[model samples]
Target: MQIDLQNSTLSSASLQKSQEARKILESRSGSGHDFLGWLQLPEEQSARVQEYLKIAADLQKLDAVVMVGIGGSYLGFKCLYESLKPAVGTPAGPEILFAGHSLDGDYHRQLLEYLEDRDFGVVVISKSGTTTEPAIAFRLLWSLLEKKHGKDAAKRVCAITDGKKGTLRQSADDLGFHSAIIADDVGGRFSVLSPVGLIPAAIAGIDIYSLLQGAMEMCDHLRNDKSDENPAVQYSAYRNGLYEEGRKIEILVYYQHAFQYLAEWWKQLFGESEGKDGRGIFPASAGFTTDLHSLGQWIQDSERTIFQTILDVEDAKSPVLQNQKNDGDGLNYLAGKTVHDVNRVALQATRQAHADGGVPSLRMKIPTIEEFQMGRLFYFFEYACGVSAYALGVNPFDQPGVEAYKKSMFKMLGKPGHA
Candidate 1:
C-alpha cells in the first residue's frame, strides 16, 4: 500500500477544503458496515455473500469462468484481475473470460464455441433481477451450464442480488441455487465492495478482503487524514474548487491501456456520485498521446470546460525497444530510445500541453502499478468520489439512470413486441 505521491501537485489551502468535504461524505455514507448507503438492503446481505463466495471459489477449480456483466460490474473486477493478474486469491483460481459485453450474436456464438467443452461456469452480476446484458447472458449461459452441470446444476449457480427480492434473487431461489450473494443498500456501479464485484474476483481467486481492507483504510484516510499533507483530501478539495470555478467535465486521461480500467473505475465513482440535480463534472476517460490524435485538438483549442486529472506513473514494467537490428526510414534517430521512453515523454508532454492551453491540469503519479498500489489507487478514487459528491450535494453511491433503463427495457421485453 506504499504509494508515491511526489508528483502530485496540491497546495495547503486545498488540503483544508478536502478535510471539510471528507466529513460531509462520511455523513452521507451513514453507518452501514460493508455497504455504502445507496439503495435499501436486507439484513442477510453479508451472510449471503460469504456463502456464495465459497462456491465461486469452488468453481475456480474448473478450467475457466465467464463473467456476465457490463459497465461497473465488468469494470471493477476486470480491473482487479488485470492489475493482480495470476495472483487473484485462491489456490484454484481459474482462467477467466468476460462475455455479454456486446450483443453481437456471432460474438456470443464464438465465445460459446471456444468454451464448448471448457468446463466453465458463469457469475451473473445484476443487483436487480434484470439488466439487459448480464440478464440475457445469464439465461443463455445458465442454459449452457444446465447442459454441462445438469438441470440440478442450479446447485452450482452463484449470484449477487438483493437479499430479499429482485429477478435474479428470486430466480436463484426458485432454482435452488444455494450459493448466490446479495448486494444490499448499494447500487450496481457502487457495488464493488458488495458482491457485484467480489464474486468475480473471488472466482478469479482475487484477495477481495484485502481489496475491501484497502477501501476501508482509504475511507478512514480520506475522512481522517485532513489537510494538504493528506493526498486524497488535497485533490478532492482542488477538484471541487475547479468544479465551482466552472470546470464541468473532469477529464481523466491516462498514458497506458493497462491503466484504462483505472478510468473505468473512476467514471462510475465520479459519474454516479456527482451527476445529480444539475451539477458535477462529467467523469470521462481518454488515452494519452493516443486520444490526443482524436480528442486532443478539441480539448486544447475548443471551448474548454474540463479539469484534466492525468494518472501518470513514473515507472512501468514495459518491454524496452532495442536497436540491435534497426531498419531505417530515419527511424535510427529514435533507435536507442525505448518505447517506455516514448511513453514517459508523452506523459510529461501532455501535461505541459494541457496546462499551456489554459486548462487547470492535475497529475497523479504512481511510482508503479501493482496490486497493492492499485488497491491504494482504487480506494483513493472511491473515497475521493464519495467526498466530492457529498460536497456537491449529491449522493455518490447510486445509479438511478441505470435502473431506469432496465425498468423500461424489462417492460418492453416483457411485452410481445420484443418478447
Candidate 2:
C-alpha cells in the first residue's frame, strides 16, 4: 500500500513528532506500553499458525460456526471476513456467522433460529466471560449446541479468552471446550492480529499465514525506515498536522463496499485510542457514490474542520459493464468499461472537487484487496494509530471512557457489584 500526502499538509514539527512517537513506541516507554504486544503480533502469531489451523480444520467440519464477541474481537475478524468473502459462492470452509456485537434480541433470536437446522459450532471471544453482550449470546448459543448435540457439544465449542483466569477460562476448563489464550497485554482493539481475530478468520478459510506475512513485512518496513517516507509515519504526521490546523475530523473515504466494515474497525481503533484527554481528531467514514448522494452536500460545504483519507483500491476485481444499445434512455457512449473503471474516475473526480471546495485529502492506494494486502493494511493503520495517539499526548492503549456506559448499564440492570 502507498500513501499520497501531496493533497495534505505535513509540517516539519509534526514529522519530528511522529519520529519521536516511534521511538517511544519502539522503546516501550510510552503510556499504556504494556499493550504494545500488537507490535510483535505478526511474527509471534505466525509461529503458531499450525495450532490455529488445526482448530479451524476441526471447526470446518460443521456446517456453520458462530463467532461471538464485541469490539475488537468482532470488528477485526468481521472486517477481514466480510472484505475477503468469496464473491460468488460459499466460503471454502464452513459458513461463519457473528454474534455478541450488539444487544438486539431480534437479531440473536433470528441467528439461533437459523442455527437450529444446521450443524453448527461456536467460538466465543472475551477476556472476561461476564461481559454482558457476548456472555448472553454465548449462553444462548451454548444451550442450543447442548440441546442439539448433547454431551458432544463440548467438542464443537472453542473459547478464546484470558490466558490464566477469567470466567470463560474457568468455564472452558470445567466443560472441556477447545480453547486458546489471549495474551494479557494485548487490548481488545489491538487484538485483531492475535488469536482473537485470527481464529475466526482461519475458520472462515482466509489465508491467515499470508495475512501475517504481509503484516510482518509491513512491520519490518516501518521499523527500518524511520523517514517521512514511511507510510505509517507519513500518515500520522499528516493527520496530526492537519488536526493542529483546525481540521478536527478525519473522514476515511473508500469507493468499494467491501471496505465498509474496515472503516468501522478503523473508527474504533482511532476513536477509542485517541479520543481522550480532551483532544483527538474525530474519525468518520464514507462509502463513495453511495454516501456521496447523502453526505456529499455537507462534506462539500460544511465547516472546514474536516479532511479526508481516501482508500484507493487500484485493481478491485469487478465485472465489465455490458452496453445497453437500445438508446431508449440515452446513447451508449461506452461499450465495455469495467465497474472499477467508473469507480476510479469517480474517485479522482471527487478528490479534485473536494480539494477545490477547501477539503484537504490524502489518498492511500493498495494494488488490490486480497489477504496479503489486507494484512499490510491492518498493520499499517494499527502502527500509525499508536504513533498518532501518542503524538496527541494520550494513552493509546486504554479506554477508560468506555467503562462509563457499562457502569451505568450495570447499575440500571441491578448487577450485584454495581450498587
TM-score of each: 0.81, 0.97
Candidate 1 residue lDDT tens string, 1-419: 33233333454555556666676555544322244652222122334446646777677777887887877777888777766663334434576888766677887888888878788777777677566677777788888888877876675567666778788888888887644554454555665656667678777767665555555555556556554556666567767777766778888888877777768777877887677777778888898778988998988887767878877777766666656454655566666777878888887777777778877776777767664466567667766666666656666665556667656776776955444
Q: Whose lDDT is greatest here?
A: 2
Lowest lDDT block of 10, candidate 1:
38-47
Residue 197 shift from truth in candidate 1, angstroms? 2.3
Query: 189, model 2: CA deviation in Å?
Result: 0.9
Off by over 4 Å in 2: 322-325, 329-331
Quote the positional error of residue 343 for candidate 2 in Å.
0.6
- In terms of TM-score, the best-performing candidate is 2
Model 2 lDDT per residue over 1-419, tens place:
88887677789999999989988998999999988889999999999999999998899999999999999989999999889986567767688889998999999999999999999999999999998899999999999999998999999999999988989999999999989999988999999999998989889889999999999999999888977788888898998999999999999998988899999999999999999989999999999989999999999999999999999999976777666858676536645788898899999999999999999999999998999999999999999999988888999999889899999999999999999
Candidate 2: C-alpha RMSD to true structure equals 1.3
Error of model 2, residue 197, in angstroms: 1.3
List per-prediction Cα lDDT, in the order shown.
0.68, 0.92
Q: Which residue pairs collide in model 2, if any?
A: none
